[model samples]
Each structure stands twice: as structure tokens, then as C-alpha cells.
Target chain A: MSAPIIAIDAMGGDYGPHCIVPACISFLAEHPSLQLVLVGQAPLLEDLIARSSIPALDRQRLHIHHASEVVAMDDRPSQALRGKPDSSMRIALELVRDGKAQACVSAGNTGALMALSRYLLKTLPGIDRPAMVTAVPTQTGSCHLLDLGANVDCSAEHLYQFAIMGAVAAEALGKVRPRVALLNVGTEDIKGNQQVKLAANLLQAASGVNFIGYIEGDGLYRGLADVVVCDGFVGNILLKSSEGLAAMISARLEALFASSLPARAVGLVAMPLLRRLRTELTPAQHNGASFLGLQGIVVKSHGSAGEEGFRSALRRAMIEVRENLPQRLHGRLEHLL
Target chain B: MSAPIIAIDAMGGDYGPHCIVPACISFLAEHPSLQLVLVGQAPLLEDLIARSSIPALDRQRLHIHHASEVVAMDDRPSQALRGKPDSSMRIALELVRDGKAQACVSAGNTGALMALSRYLLKTLPGIDRPAMVTAVPTQTGSCHLLDLGANVDCSAEHLYQFAIMGAVAAEALGKVRPRVALLNVGTEDIKGNQQVKLAANLLQAASGVNFIGYIEGDGLYRGLADVVVCDGFVGNILLKSSEGLAAMISARLEALFASSLPARAVGLVAMPLLRRLRTELTPAQHNGASFLGLQGIVVKSHGSAGEEGFRSALRRAMIEVRENLPQRLHGRLEHLL
Candidate 1:
């Protein structure tokens, strides 16, 4: 049995090939059997690959598929897909569709990646809409949050499906009987809007998934539940706000420790403990955005992701592939839907 | 002119009279002529006040009104007010209603505060509903965010009213021609739901307030606009999530700095810069939550507020009072409505 070929969208993200090339080398070193297909402007990728310290045989495992066009970060997803059919993002999706690559990964415009994935790989049977699942770090550990910016306007049924996909993902990550919760304004059944109230009712009645009641935004970081579910709009707000707030807080703490000599001494002594906590809180360290409910595994790394962040994303993709997450999700959701 | 008699909900908040008493003492120290009527459990308030470090003349400036009941943090605002008329929150609001106190402040159940404030003072004429306006720390400075958890479902007109009030509040803080923005998922005019779109259009056409276009969730902390307006649901999420993330990140950074010797050394040097940043980022340091669109000035401190946090809240209340914000807001919104 040969290794699985993973197509890497090379000409994407803030650091572009600099981060992607190093991450690919790191991944290949850890998984020597892994095959790599780099999709982007070939010259740039080659330049980056040449700078890496990986051996020739390992380099032989890498292939480049030149894509003349690249989608801008701010480009509309559907418009980009329609205009540039041969974009690195689109081509990477094609590789997966054609069985040349088992999965696709991009740190490009999220909208374009999601759109192209849906257009090329298509939604899995029984899945109404594909979801973007990502992990959020909490007090206990990491918890999976689903629909983290796909399907902005979700119906009660949509939320139910998200719970199923999220539960499957959580199980794959080793959380047995993953407690699924519908994110709402409050914990009470009657606390949210009409949509949340209806979703709560449906989630409660559903089986297989461990349907915990409502969890508020605060509970997301408290690690109250294993799986938190919501529509893309709310989830996106949560995801971005959480990330932004983390940055804001980090900045604030730095300022606080710098205020006085006494505080600086405290900060110096507390450095070890602070680093451990920061490692736990950094979102990039915990989860890569996974485009779920697609026929192929498509992980969307953060656009600003650097080498370490991209490495984490690639590692997440490897985990998803090993667990055969898509097949498991389809199996679980097929009959229920 | 006599000093305004302000009613303090003495039994409210996590630290209760312990923090509130000191906050009042500190506030009185600065504003010697200010009068206060403390309402709470009679014996408890008397004991706390007697033990307080406030001077004899300062003590003479305070009058205690005994109430036997208290509202728990988790209690529903409406239900709690109805069930406990003698609750400190209720008595404080009643003091304002009966003309015994010019204004009221509480660090109690937010829902209860809103409900009692409305039930007692009612809405200022032409102000459809009151909004919970709070200050958020931003890169540039602090910005006012209104409807921070008052009315969950707001009409376009209601949002416009919030904008007007927010702008007036900003002006009260000395920001002339404050840039007002309607909070949305995206900045594009066509983006967001019908409510947001309509609100944007209304704000753009409305007179007096300097209406900026749409501002996304990310724009809240960017200081892109002087006054950001949103429905209660989103506002609540933004406010609470900011607080939650701030705490989470602070804790995380502390752990990071303490993780190892090298990190601790780096942390020691970075301590002053970090402290300055943290002070700028801590929302508690800037302003208290204001019940805007009310007939009188009322600020709700965080329920978990300590002495310092309460002092900040009191300072914010003093500023609002000094600026004659409620009158200015009423003047602007009355003609527009």
C-alpha cells in the first residue's frame, strides 16, 4: 500500500511558500511515506522547496502542478471560482476529485475554498450543507465547534446536521460520547430566539449524538461541552471574536507586565507558567479549520498562518485522513437524514 | 444649587457593600458635596458603612434606607423585580422614582437592573426603548457600544434611536461630530440582514448624528467608529465575549511567561510594555455600563466588580452626570423621532 497524496495550495496565505514549503518539509519528515502534490505558481514553490533541508528522496515525494492564477484574499468566493476555474484552489480540489490526491488543503480565501470544495467534490450524500468545523481551546481541553463560518443562515435541521458531523469529528479525536451543545444566548431552553428555540427542540429529540442543552458564548472557552453547534454567522463571530480577543488580551497582558519593576519581576518569575497557558490558549496551536460534509477532506488554514501554524493544519489533515472522517460522517448521517 | 442625591444599590455585586462602600467613599473624597442614599439590608448596610474608612462629614453625606431582600445574579430581571419589591435593586430604583434620589446605580443582576429601571423611570419621551451602552477598549481609544443586552429584537427605528443616544453620549465625552456606525456582518451596504440594512439606511438619512456606513464585528475593537450600534443579542455577545476572552488570554499569557527560564527572562523585559497594553485593553478601567435612553443617568457596574472596578464605574457615572448626557440625548432624539 502506498502513502496518500495530499495536495498543498502553495501560493496562499500571508507567508505564502515560505510557510507552506517549510510545513510540507516538516510534515514529510514526520511521515516519510506521505506523498505531496504542491499546487500553485511552480517557480515560487520550487524556489522555496530548494531552501528546505529535506533529503532528495523526500523531495522526490513532492510534485508541483503549476497554476497561473491565484485568488486574492478579499475576492468573492463564487466570483473567483467562476472567473478562475484553473486557480490553485480550484486545481487542488480537482486533484482530490481525480483521485490524484486523497485530500486538499488551502490557507487561501476561506469563502473561495469552501465554494470550490462544494463545486468540485460536491456535498456528501445525506448532508444538506457542508460545514466548517474547528477546535476551540477551553479550560478542560479542546472542544470542536461546527459551522464556524459556512451556511450563514441555518435552519433548525441544519444545526441538527452540524451536531452529527461535529460529533463524528469529536469521536475521531478520541472524545467518547462527545457532548453536543447548541450555542445560544443562554442555557435555558426558552432563552434564545425562535431559531435557537426550534434548534434546541430538534437537537434534544435527535439520537446518536450526546445532545447536551444550550451553551452560551462564555461556555465555549470554559470547556463545558465537547461539541458546540451554531450557524455560520454566529460561529464566525465566535471564532473571530475569540481569536481577536485572544490577541487583544495578549497585548494587554504584555502592557500590564511592563507597567512597573515589581510587575516585571512577577512576570519574569511567572514566565514558564505564562508560556504554558499561552500554548493552551493560542487557537492556531489547537485546531485547523476543517471543511466538513465534503466528499474529500479540505482543511483551511488561517490566511495569516505562518510555518508553525501551517504545520499544525497539515497535522490536523493527517489526523482526519487517518480516521477516515468523511466516510464515518457519511455513515452516521446517511440513515438519519 | 444642591448636590444630586444618587441612590446606591448597596447589596448588589459580588463584593456587595465591601466594594460599593469604598467606591462611594473614594467618589465622595473627590466630589465632597455629592449626596448618596444607600439602599440594602438595613443591618448589613449600617455595619458596613460604620466600618468604612469614610470621614465623619463624608458619613453625614450618606443616608441608609434598609431593604431586607437581594436579587441573585442568575435571577430573571422581570421575575425578580416582581417577586422582591424590597430587593436592593428595586428600592434603589424606587428612590429615584419617588424623587428621594436623582439617579440610581446597581452592580446587580443586569436583567433586573434593566427591568426595574424601565419599570420605575420608564423610557424618555420618543425613546422607544432604553439601551445598555458600554465602553469597549480599542487600539485608538474607547468607543461606545449600545444595546449591549437590553432589547434582543430591535426594529430599524429602535436602532436609529440607539445611534442617536450613542452619538450624544460620545459628544458628552467630548467627541464632537462622533462617527456613528451600524454593526453588521460586513461593511458593504448590501450586507447583513434586513434589520441592519434598514438601520444603515435610516442612520445615513437621519439628521444630527454623523452616520458612518456599516462596521463589521472586527471593527468594534479597531476604533473605526466613535459609536457602534447593534441589537441587544449581538451587543451582549460582543461585550461578554470580550470580557471572557480578555480573562482567558490574560490567564494564558501568565502561563506562557511562567513556562520556562528563557521565556521568564523574555517576560521580564517585556513586562512594562505588557502592563501598559493590558491597562489599555481592560474594559473595566474605562467606563461602566450605562442604561441609555432613560430619563436619568444610571450606570450598571459589573456584578463581579471589585473596589477598583466600582470606582471606575462611579467615575463614569460622574462624567455622564457632569456632561448632562440624558438631556442632550433627549434633545437630539426627540426631534428626530
Candidate 2:
């Protein structure tokens, strides 16, 4: 098989080139057949790359697309996309658009990335909107939540499409006939607003997908359903709130363990258990955010991603490319729309 | 001070009279000044009351308001209220309306309870809509979250009112000048939908409430702000999702601890730390769900609540009654409306 080319937004995340360079070198060392296009200002990218242990052929396999502007983390999505035409994100999307790379990966402004991907690549046939889907680690396993922040206001029909797309994605990850659910105020069919009720009814009767009734917000990290669907607005809230709560709980546990001699002794014996729980909940272990329904693959890394985080994202992108996720999604959803 | 009379929905909740009777008996034993009115079928109420050990005065304090019809958990709120006039929940609400009880407590259908509260007691002065406020256990401490279920579809103006009411409730809990925040997709003023942006702008400028800027969903369990405001719909999703995730995570940890010999050995040492974490995250520790913006005090316990849960609800009801939360909210929000 030919090498899969991935365009990386090197100047994006919190640590930027410092994190991206090492992660890319590490990834390239592990995957000899992989080619990469690192999009950023050449000077800084070169400075970071020069300090890495990536081999000469691996360097030859790497390409640079110089872009001067970097979108700040807080920049508005629409404004950022429109203002920075030659941004790493925009240029990276262009690589996939022009068939230079199989996919684009970024830890940049999430909204801008979504907007640019949609603007440059457009939605796949039969898909009205493209959603950002991410895996949240749960006790049983990780569950996929869709439209995390892509389209805030969605209709029942839009959610139905998300369910189909999400199910397809989950299946690719080995969940055969993944249990699909609409995120609502309660578990009952009649519990939510008109949109949710309408969506629930349609989902209950929908063909092919496993419609597992309504799962509430608290179910997001519980693995209650393999694919939890909601409008971008609610999905985003659930995603962030779960992340915040996990962090808060973890911090509190650390404080309790470090508080006193007895607690410290308890912590020492429980170290293995705590380590397992911590590993189970680590965001890096489940870091990829896929832009579903796009014509080409686009994976979003955390904005604050460091070396390991970026590598995790790259690994995820490679899997999506190998699975031909976008092509499969297009095939499944085309007829539905 | 006169002993406060509280109406208990004895035949409500998942466990119904079993939990309610024990809770009532426990409350009576603890508080000498408390009086109870058990509302349910006469036969069931009488049987449960007869089984209990009570002094003549306490027994006299326990009056039964026979309600033959019972609203099923899945019954539509408006339909159930209109159709089943003599349901336990309806009778409980009527007691408050007739001034027969100072407050009403239930672990029944939350929607039915909210509807009954709105129908019978009506909204207080200057309040357009009622909200269900509950104390959520967080890493820092417990914080008050309003609009947990009521008024799911809300306007910016309604959320502003909710903010005012939430602040008053927080102050009643002794957090002076409580920091109020609008829950949004992002903390930035420019992020989220039009509703969030408009609400954020209004909240930032609002003088009566101590309006902080936006807070993300993850902030809820971390105690980032005292009062986190959102439309009831989103708030309900946040509240329930956090709860579901916490419960699911805890259960998963237990399973992991029992997985193998090494895991079990680790579990023995980690039991205390895990116990402390579990205590911090326990739903019982955060039991009260207050029907805010109502003229009378009404607390909704969880449907499967036991004696301890009901007692917590009773205590919260007493505190709200003592603080005169309704009157304080009325005074604070009258000008804004």
C-alpha cells in the first residue's frame, strides 16, 4: 500500500511546533510508510524540527506549507476563517482538497477548522451538516458523541443524520450495530422538547440503526449508548462538562490522598488502583475528534495538546484513513438524504 | 415559632410509602416541632401510620388526606394533572394551596410535581416562570443550580430572572454576593448561540445579581461559580448528565477493583480514598430539589429516595421557609421584571 499523507497544523495547539515536531518524528519513526506535510511558518517549524531525531528519508518524506497567521484559541470561528485565508488550518484543508494529502489534522480553533473544512471540502452527498464527533472514555469503554460543537442549533432531521453518521463511525471502531441514543432531560420518549420528541419517534422507527431510546446528559461518560446524539449546542455542553467534572474529581482525589499521613499511606497502597483509574480517564488516551460527513478526513486535536496528545491525534487520523471512514460515511448517508 | 406543617406524598416515588413512612417517622423523631400530613390512599396511609411508633401528639400531627388516584411515573405532566385530579401529587400540592401545610415534599414524577406546583400554588409576584433548583455536590462544596427541569425552553429574559432567583437562594445558603454565571458552549463572550451571547451581555450588565461572565458545563461540579445559569433545558441536561456519569464511573471503579487478585489487593488499600471520593459524589449528600419562583416551599426528592433522602429534603424545605426565599426573590426581581 502507498504511504498515507497527513497534513498537520504544526503552529496550532498550546505548545505548537514544540509539541508537534517531536510527536510527528515519533509517529514517523513508528510508521515507516507514513508521509507528512507540516503547515506552519518555516523558520519556527525548521527550528523545532532541527532539534528532533527524525531520519533524513523521514525528513525527505516531510513537506512544509508556510503560513504566517496563527488563530488564537479564543478567536471566533467565522472571523478567524475569513480573516486568515492563508492560515495553517486553511492551507491544511487545501492539501486534502487538492488530493496532496489523504487527510488534515489540527489542534487549532475548532470552529474555524469545522467552518474551513465545510467551506473548502463541502459536506458529503446526502449529509446536510458535518459534525465533530469525539470519543469520551467511560467505565465500559469509550462512547462516541456527535456534533460536539459543529452546528449548535439542529432540527430533528439533523439529529437523525447525526445518529446514522455516528453509528457508522462507531461500527468502524468495532461496535457492531452500535446502540444509538438521543441525549435528553430524561430517559423516556415523552420527556424532552418538540425537537427531541420528534427525533426520538423517528429514531425508534428508523431502519438499520440500533435506537436505544433517550439517554440523559449524565449518561455521556457512562457508556450508556455507543453513540449519544444531540444538537451541537447540548453536545458541546455535555462534552465540556464531563471533561471539567472528571478533572475536578481527579484533583479532589489527589488532594485527599496528599492531605495527611493516614491518607498518604492509603494513597501508597492504592497507587496501582489510582493509576489504573487515572489511565482509564486520561483525555490523551481518547483524544481524536473526527469531523464527520466531510468529503475528506479531518481530525481535531486538543487546543492545549503537547507532544503525546498530538501523537495520539495523528494515530487516530491514521486509523480513520486506513478504515476509509469518510468514504464509508458517504456511502451510507448518501441514500438517506 | 410555630411548628411547620409539611405534606408528604406517601404513595409517590419508586419506593413509594415504604421510603416515605420511614422518612416521616425519622423526621418526627428528630424535630419535635414538625407536623406531617401524609397524602395518599386512606387504607395505605393508615396501615403505614399504624405500623410506626409515635406519641399521641405526633400521631395527631400526622393527618391523612386520601388520594385514590396515583400518577404513573411516565404519565405526561399536563395530561396527568388534568386527568388525575385526586392523585397523591395533586393532593399534596392542594394542601399547600389551601394553607393546610407550610410546604409539600415529594419523590414523584418531577414533571407532574412541577406542573402541580405551577397550577396550585402559582408563580410568586414578579416571577414569570418557576424553576427547579437543586444542590449539586461539587469538589469545592455544594452549589445551587436552578432550572434543573422546569421551563426547558427559556428566553434570555427568563434566564436573567433565574439568575436573580439562584443568587438569592445561594445567599440564603450564606454565599453573599454570589458569583452568577451563564452556562455556555465557551467562556468567551462571543462564543455560543445568540441566546447565550445576549444572556451573557445582559448578565454582565445586570446590577441586582452578581453576574460573572460565562461558565462552561464542566464548571458545575468544580464549584467555579456559585450560581450557574442556563435555560432549563440545558440545565436539566447538565444536571442529569453529570449525575449519570458520576454513578456510572463509580460503578465501573467497583467492577475494576473486583477484576483480579492484584486489582483486589489494590482495592483494599484504595477503599478509604475511594470511599471519601464516593462520599463527596453521593447523590444523598445533595438531595434537595427546590421548586424556585413559587409562593410556597416545595422540595422534590429522588424517586427511589429512602428515609435519609426524604429527611434531607425536609431540612432543605425548612431552611427555604425560614430564609423566606420566595419573598427575598420577589424583592430582588420585582424591579427587573
Candidate 3:
């Protein structure tokens, strides 16, 4: 029952400790129970924290773990793995592997994050590879989408595994017997490729899952299902496309509001709701995309995220840590497999 | 210089002739120079057209080419191709092949439309397969996205050909050497799957292509590229997801507006612009997704589209006919290959 320790890769992302330290400080102040270990260059971490002027009580919960080297944004995942052994990303993951931290969060290179996470944490039993999952904002609420970019070329079994992990993960996010569906071109049984059809067959026969049949991309936004499963290739495009569309609509609305006095006056009242609407419709904007099926939680934040965005990632890590998501998946695997 | 004649599959889609016959009548009336042949059950189409009370002059331009059979909504593409030779979708396509119609438009079974079109019209020289391309509304304008749902599993060469076809199609829609990009998860050089990377290499090396590097899904909406190419699976999901997100956003806005009296007053002013916004952002709502790389033009409409949606499809077909899209693509093939 002791306070949970969440590790932050302080030197990750487009902006390093400067963007992340304040987020960690804010997160600690808001949640009195959780502790944070900022892993990065020692002097820089201490300096960033010192400049924050945090209250002494919250500051006590924040600790700095040093790693001399940093993983560059442009470094290849394999290169980052073989080289940069003492990098912040690697060290943060190691802390989780050694049980020093319940979870690790980073805003660095996605491939590097996935590679380091899979290499250091390994996969749960019955899981072939670790898939990335994120809570995509839907109309009614949110749905958990998986394999965001972890395994691009997934087999039917891999998809089935994602469904199980997604259903289990969705439950952790607060849905009972979450309706699981496959992301496909059409809802018809014959609409998709062989892999999707095979995955559908497996889901139908599974004992524990509430298989809801096939769902198209539109269904994802409409909140037709609580858990949507797709291979990394499809999932990545879906997420990125939604993000792009949301951004475009927001820009267009801003331009329209600015065009005329009446429009601008209306926009004065509408701007806040419209902005919230944009965020709600965008799946990727939800910020914390976690690598699922791993031995421990590793949430990937968007690079160049401001303080608010970085804090959202930290909040995501805290949720998984409290839910004990990995252990829950581990517990559910025997039945699903 | 003869007026173009478009063949319509009146018995196709979810609503069949009830939704299509009036659209064809309206199209003929709107464009004085173009003609249309309603290809469906003679008695039903004639009855509906007669009920429309069309003016005699426009009526002369509208003809009926009877289709004795119908393709069921749930019929497989292979089944429709082999079993229903006299079906509305097949007959419309045949009209193009026979030179009686310059182009064909259908809101029928997509698989059937694609299968029958390929079988009747065949692919152009150096073209592996036909792709579905639609004009998706972006913030600034619209971009032509290809492989909407024609080829599920595309090779690197297939993507390369899609780019060429998309570029040519975009020219038909009025863009100069449309900035072509491969649709990917990330814009980075090493972000996507192997096929995408290989396609990127081909596009980069090929002449006559205005390769603008890679574009993520968001770029598709931001109007970053004039032509965005992806495999059918990814493209379909992106389009459908956009449609769903747009619809949800519209519904939420409506609810917000109706929540109070002052909000309703603002809503009255904002409603028309917001309605246009919904249609503009949804790629699937554009109604006419044409099959590119064929020897003849064949456009597919959404199966359950209303009257206006059907007219949009007819309008798309007319554009293709005027542009002589097939001949244009055929002419461009030599330079590209």
C-alpha cells in the first residue's frame, strides 16, 4: 500500500528535462500519494527541479535518477538498443525491470521506446509481441485501441492476442465485459482480408470475450464498441488520420471565426466547446499511448509535447500503475489462450 | 464534342431505384449537355422517372437501358460477377465497354463494382490493378486519395502506380503535378512498413512524379499533398474514420446548440457553416470514389447515399467523362513507366 513510484525519462522527447520536469512536479502536487523518479543527466535534472520553486512537501516525493548518456531523437531503435546502454530511456525501463518503478513513461523516439521496452521488459506469457494501446476519445466516452505501431505485420493469432489484451485493458479503464470488435473495411463477414476473418473466427469462439463482430473506422469514433482491435499497420494509420482531421477542422473553425465580427462574437462563446470537441474527436491527442502485453507498463508520449501534454502522459502511467494492468493481463492470459 | 452519356446502376445500393432514378433525372436537368441511361429493372425505373414529371426537353436526354437482374446487397463480388451478368451494376459497366456510355456510376456492392469493372474494362497497359480515388476535403481544399477499397493487399509497385494515377486524376480535378505522397504512420524516412518504404524509394527515384516525401493521415486533411496514396485497407479505414468522426462532431454540436436558448440563437447562424464543414471533412461523404487505372471510367457511390449524394456520384462520372480520365491515364503511362 506504499506510494507507487513512476519513472520518467527526463531527457527524452524533442524538448528534454525542461518540458518533463515541470510536468512531473505538477503531477506530484496534484496527486499526493504517487512518487516520481526523473531519470536523466544528474546536474540538469537537479537544476530544472531547483528552478521550478515547488513546495517542499511535493518536492520530497520527486527523486532524480542519473544516466550520463541521452538517446537522440534521430537514433535508430536498434542502434539505440545496441548502443546507449546508459541512456535515460534504457535506464527508466531497467528500473521497471528491476521493480524500482511500477511504470516508465517517455516522449522520445517511438521505435526506440518500443524496442527498449520489448527488449528490457519482455512480453507476458502467451503474448508474442508487445502492442501499443491508447485510449482514443469517442463520441460517448473513449475506447481502448491497440497495436498502435508495435507489430505491423500481425497474424490472426496476434490479432486475437490484441483483442484479449485490449478487452482486459479496457476493463482497467472502467468498462464491464467490454464489447470487443475488429477494425475492418466493412462490417460484413466477407469484407476484410484473410487475417481479419480468421481473427473474427477466433474471437467468436473465445469464452470470456464479448465479441461484437466487425466494426469499420467510423464505428471507432461513434463509440460502437469499447475495445477495438487491429494490427499495428492499420491502427497507426487510423490514429494518425484522426489526429490530422481533427487538427484541420480546428484550424478551419478558427479561420471562420476570425473572418467576420459576428462570427468572432459567436466564436467567443463557442471557442472553448469547439476546442474541447476537437480534442474529443482526435484519438491520438489523448496523449498517453502505452505499450501493451509487456511485462511492465511503458507509456509513449508525443515528442515536443508541452507541459500539459507531458502531464497527461504521466497521468496515464499512474492509472496503469494503480490498476496493476500487466498483472491483470497476466492473470487473464491463461483463459484467453 | 458530343454530349457525354453516363450509365447509372439504378437498382444498386441499399435503396435501389427509389434513391437513384430521381438523382439521374436531376443530373440530366442540371447539366443540359450531358445525357444519362438508367440501367436497372425497366418497369421500376420507368415508373419512378415518369413519377418525377420531368420536362420534355431534359426527358429526351434521359434513356432507360433495362437490366433484368439485381445484385443483392449481401452478394459476394465473385458471386455477383459470375452469377448476375444482367445485373444493374454489370449492365452499367457494359454500357461503357460497348461505347454507348462514356462512363458508368454505381452505388452497388463495392466488390461487385470493382470486380465487374475490371472484368469488363480491364486495366490499362503497365497498370497492375485499378484503384479507387476520391477527393477528400482538407482545411484549404481537397486532396485526391487513392486505393479507397479496390486492392486490399498492395505491393510497392501497386502503390507507385496509384501515385501516377492519382496525380493524373488530380490534374483532371485541376492541380498542377499534384504533390504526391505515400500515406504512412509517420513522415519520417524509417517510419512505415516495408511495402511503404519500398514504395517511397520507387516514388523518389521515378521521374514525372512530384514526390513530396511521406505524409501521415493528418497531412491528408491538412491539404499538404494533392495526392495521397495508400493500400486499400489503410485508405478505406482513413476515409471511414473521418466520416465517423465528422458525423459524431456534428451531432455533438447540434446537441450543444439545442441545450439552451442563447446557444440555439448562435446555432442558427452557425448551422449552415457547420453542415458544410461536416460534408467537406468527410472523404466518404464526397459520394464519388472512381476506379482509376481502368481502360474506362467507373465511379462507385456510397451504397446508402441519399438523392443529393447520388447526384454527386453522377457529377463525378461526368467530370471523368469530360476529362477522358482513362485515356489520360493511358497517355501518362508511357511517360511514367
**Top of the candidates by DockQ:** 3
- Every candidate's DockQ is 0.32, 0.64, 0.78
Candidate 1 at residue B34, lDDT? Answer: 85
True-contact fraction in model 3 equals 0.79
lDDT, candidate 2, A1-337, per-residue tens: 5789999988887777887878888889889899999998988888888877778988987888898888877777777778988788888889999999999989988888888899999988878899888887765787888888888788898899899999999998789889998888887756788888898877777778899888877676667889989898887787777767667767776777788886677567555665566545545334768899989999999887667778888988999999999989987876555
lDDT of 1 by residue, B75-99 (tens): 8876776888789888888887887
Can you write out model 1's per-residue Cα lDDT over A1-337, one digit (the tens) per residue? 3588889888888777788888898788889889889999999888888877789889999899999899888788767779997788889889999989888888988878988989899998878789998887876677898887677677888888888889999999899999999887677654766777887877777777688898876677677899998877667666665655565554555566667887677666554555555544556434468988989999988888777778788888888888988988889877667
Which of 2 and 3 is ahead in lDDT?
Answer: 3
TM-score winner, 1 or 3: 3
Query: Candidate 3, which segments miss by more than 4 Å at Cα?
Result: none
Q: For residue A233, what is the lDDT in candidate 1?
A: 68
Interface RMSD of 1: 3.8
Ranking by lDDT: 3, 2, 1
TM-score of each: 0.89, 0.95, 0.97
Q: How much is the lDDT of residue B42 in candidate 2? A: 90
**Ranking by DockQ, best first?**
3, 2, 1
Tell me the spans in candidate 1 whose CA falls farther than 4 Å from its real position. Answer: A43-54, A252-287, B185-191, B212-218, B256-287
Candidate 3 TM-score, C-alpha based: 0.97
Q: With candidate 3 superimposed using the best TM-score fit, by how many Å does residue A141's alpha carbon deviate from the native?
A: 1.3
Q: How many clashes (backbone N, Cα, C below 3 Å) per candidate?
A: 40, 3, 1
Q: How much lDDT does candidate 2 score? A: 0.81
